[model samples]
Target: MATLEIRDLHVSIDTDQGAKEILRGVDLTINEGEIHAIMGPNGSGKSTLAYTIAGHPRYTVDSGSITLDGEDVLAMSVDERAKAGLFLAMQYPVEIPGVTVSNFLRTAKTALDGEAPPLRAWVKDLKSSMEALRMDRGFAERNVNEGFSGGEKKRHEIVQLELLKPKFAVLDETDSGLDVDALKIVSEGVNRVKESTGLGVLLITHYTRILRYIKPDFVHVFVEGRIAEQGGAELADRLENEGYDRFVTSTPVA
Candidate 1:
């Protein structure tokens, strides 16, 4: 089974004033078919952890190690990481003005698999996946996220997740800006992918609404760049009612 391991990870970023530490010392392990939900208040370094794992240049790893199935993830470049079965769905999906959605997805699939999929099979799969996500057929012809709505962009991200079938996915605030109906549809898509592929997930969010559909196996409360508490799905229920007030007050200012 595939496993992503993070050990005492410390990350920092350069700023106008000075260097600022983000992830203090995060240690977690996600195996295939497991879902880990990370819930925290704003500015608690949640997105920093996601970006660091994805090998973002802006976030510097100060210490510790990240390994994927015994391979050193920290040593791999961003694309190399993706090729190794790591995927990150960004909070704000970027627009590729000239590339059509179909072309971009196929190119990515070809790169990851090291062989171009058969044209007929690829087209059929693309059409089916889009229809399942309730995306119109014309979306395949349009430029990637060029004129798409927020919900459309999010659904497109799920389309990539389903088609790419990565070993692990780090979703950074995917539920943000989505309405109730859109949220359920996106969450259902994620669930379907996980069930089919045994895909591991590290879901980051502030509210518990998405949890109603995704149903995390483990719930981790992130406070001031560190995980303060962890438990089973029941933890999410407590968080939904209690919020992160207790954790916020306990964390020291930087």
Candidate 2:
């Protein structure tokens, strides 16, 4: 079984005001087939943790260790990290204006596997995954995320996740801006991928609504760049009712 481990991670960003630390000694572990939900208020460094794991150039890991199994993830390049089975579904997926969805998926798959997937099998898998995500077949010819709705973009991200079959995925606020129906559909897509591939998930969200559909084995409360508390799925219920008021002094954006 594969495992991702983050130990005392400290990350910073270069702002106009110089380097400002975002993650302060964060630590966590995710084993294969485990779903870990990280719920927190705004500016709690939840997204920072996700970006750090995905090897985003904006975030600087000053002192820490990120490892997949025994391999050092911190030392790997961004594409190298993806090849090592670490995937990040960004909060705002960028629009690739010139790249069609089919081309982008195939290119990414080829890069990760070090070989081109046979055209017939690749097309079959792509069509099947898009159908499961309720994506229109026409999307295959459309430029990636070009003029797509928020839900559509999120669904496309899941399509990548399903097709790529990553060992671990860091979903950053995937539930954001999704309507009730869209949320259910997207959540089901994630659950289906996990069931089929035993994919480990580190889901970051501000509400418990998504948790109801994608039940996490562990719930972590992130406060001020650190994990303030941790518990089982029941912890999400408490957050739904009580919120993070007791954890922090100010009212956090839910």
Candidate 3:
């Protein structure tokens, strides 16, 4: 099975004042076919972890390593990460003004796979996944995330998740700004992809609402740039009841 490993990972970014450390030393291991939820309050470095794993140049890795099945992930380029079966669904999906949804998805698939998919089969899969997410057929012709409602943008991300068929996916704040119905629909789309592809997920969020729909195999509490607590699905229930006060007050690891 594929494994994504992070050991003693320290990350920082250059701000106006100076370089600010974000991830102190985070160690995590995710295997195929598991959903690991990383939950914490805002600015706890949850989103930083997601972007760092995706190799965004903004976050500098001060030390440690991120490996995919013993391969040096940090050595690979951003596109190489995706080609190696890693996908990141951003908190704020960006708009590609001139690129239509169908073209973007197809181009991405072609880039990842080294060749275009059979056109007929690609169209069929695209239509099916979009329908499962309850996206209108008209969306296929619309520009990528251009003027889409927040919920629609999120659903579109999941559509890419299903079509890309990555071995691992980092979803940052996917549940934010979604209403009751939209939340459930997005959650269903994620669950469907997991069931079909055994996709390992690192789902980052602040609340337990998304957990209700997409059950996590493991729940991790991020505080001060490190995992403060971890447990099974029950941990999420406790967090929903108790919040992060206990974890927040603890001393951070150096």
Number of the top-ranking candidate, with TM-score as the measure = 1
lDDT of 3 by residue, 1-254 (tens): 99999999999999898898889899999999999999988778998999999999999999999999899999999999999999999999999999999999999999999999999999999999999999998999999999999999999999999999999999999999999999999999999999999999999998889999999999999999989899999998898899889878645422
> In candidate 2, residue 169 scores what lDDT?
98
Worst 10 residues of 3 by lDDT: 245-254
Cα lDDT over the full model 2:
0.94
lDDT of 2 by residue, 61-131 (tens): 99989999999999999999999999999999999999999999999999999999999999999999899
Query: How displaced is residue 211 in candidate 2, in Å?
Result: 0.7
Backbone collision tally, model 2: 0
Off by over 4 Å in 3: 250-254
**Clashing pairs in model 3, backbone N/Cα/C closer than 3 A:** none
**Against the hidden true structure, what lDDT does model 1 obtain?**
0.94
Per model, how many backbone clashes are there? 0, 0, 0
lDDT of 1 by residue, 1-254 (tens): 99999999999999898988888899999999999999988888899999999999999999999999999999999999999999999999999999999999999999999999999999999999998889999999999999999999999999999999999999999999999999998999999999999999999998999999999999999989899999998999998899888888644323
Q: Report how far residue 149 has shifted in candidate 2, in Å.
A: 0.4
lDDT of 3 at 108: 98
lDDT of each: 0.94, 0.94, 0.94
